[model samples]
Target: MRKHCCTPGQTTRTPSGTKRPSVTGSFPADPILPEMVSLAGGEFLMGSAEPHAYPLDGEGPVRTESVPPYAVAATTVTVAQFDLFVTATGYLTDAERFGDSLVFEAALPHDARAHPRVAETPWWAIVGGADWRHPAGPDAEVDAVRDLADHPVVHVSRTDAEAFCRWSGTALPSEAQWEFASRGGLSQQPYPWGYERDPGGEARMNIWRGEFPGAVSTPTGKTFTAPARSYPPNGFGLFNTTGNVWEWTTGVFDQRRRDHRAVIRGGSHLCHESYCRRYRTSARSGTTPDSSSGHIGFRVITAK
Candidate 1:
């Protein structure tokens, strides 16, 4: 099976050395709340050694990874938090600037018109007017789910994530920092919590509980993104580190590849054991820097 993050498709590669947007806005006067957890970084085996691991995705060999002490968000950035940034800076997200974004076909209305699909992943549709605010399409209103403001923000690109990081006075975690933190001080474990996906028949994460690209059987009744704290946190007090949404990291997908794709970790609500088993701590995928989709978001870290 071909390895894919979530929305798999070809993207126009950007030239190297393109300057990222400069940081703007004055720092918040009040100290941001202690929503971040400080980790005493150390060495741990990174990647997977399972026979079923996808070799092409480079999810194996179980090499040791070391990271310095740092702090990471206890949860992914939420819609409310992002909204504040937008309101303050009037920043336009990549999806907003592009006028559309990739949405999971399942999220659209049944009567929605057929949109162009990614050749490799037909479940993804290019929905016009789809962005962080209009997650489904033009007709959907974010106010409908205003109660879910604590849920992780979606339809954001690397550029948008970087901008958030800049404004927040934090930075995107490096791949090593992400993996090391996600491991939760565990060594060579498949997941952050433990060896089993669910310990004692309880779901530890918010991954697909049913057939992928079709039905959702999550007992929690959460079909798409759940509240950031929907499930129990890992050993490091981090929530949704394995699933919920694939998170952007500062690492490149592959140093050898010439494309501008960046590394994305965790999985998403769409991931299932039958296919797209990327919810493990070491599992990884990539997307173009400019690409934005409903299943991709990010977290930030502050180095100590």
Candidate 2:
């Protein structure tokens, strides 16, 4: 079975192979920044040894990793936030440049589903015009940004995220920094909140309910990304850290592999217990630096 976090869609090996218009003007001096949570930073147990964890993804061995003080955005960057960065920089995301990206099959219109799908995971369709602006391809409404303003921006590549970080005077959190913050002070727990997937029988994060890839519906009636702040924060006051979208981090997936696949933390709304048990803090996956998909997004951080 394919690991849930292993959705790279069609990745262009070399980022330089897909360049677009150069960014205009200079970085905005006052780009809007997302709400950031300051972590006092300390040693925390990292990785998992649970039977359900994907050992091949390097999600185990349970070691202690320490991070210095840093501040992470409480939520993943939203559509509105990404729009502001693009508007300020005249930047084009790799998806926009490629003229297509991966879209979840369930989110596509019936006709769009006919598009070529990733052979490894048929759930992802290679969708034209599926950039952050047109999450559902050209079918997305003109006000898509406003409609998804509060939702985590999807279909953004790590390079796109780095551009946003550069413009916003921030940086993508390292895997250690992200895990420390997502753990929310919890020590080696399966989730940010605690051991229970849903403590008190309540959903603490936005993830696939029922089943995955084909459920087509959820208990909340949302088959797509939720508002960035839809759920309650963890103990450290981070929102949607485990689900909603996979967040890009600064670290590489593996040192041994020559592939420049960067690490992506958390899972997304597509995750389910039946498969893709990656909504936990320690869980991780990786994709090409230039790959973009509807379920991939990122947050930024600042060193203290």
lDDT to native, each model: 0.80, 0.81
Give the worst 10-residue stretch by lDDT in candidate 1.
12-21
Q: Let me know the TM-score candidate 1 reaches against the reference structure.
A: 0.91
**What's the number of clashes in each of the models?**
0, 0
Clashing pairs in 2: none
In the range 150-225, model 2's lDDT, one tens digit per residue, is: 8889888888888888767789999999999998898988898889899889988878887566667544443388
What TM-score fits each model?
A: 0.91, 0.92
Rate residue 188 of model 2 by lDDT: 82
For candidate 2, give the lDDT of residue 23.
45
Q: Per-residue lDDT of 156-219 in model 1, one digit per residue for the tens?
A: 9998999998888888999889998888878878888888988899888888886776664654
Model 1 clashes, total count:
0
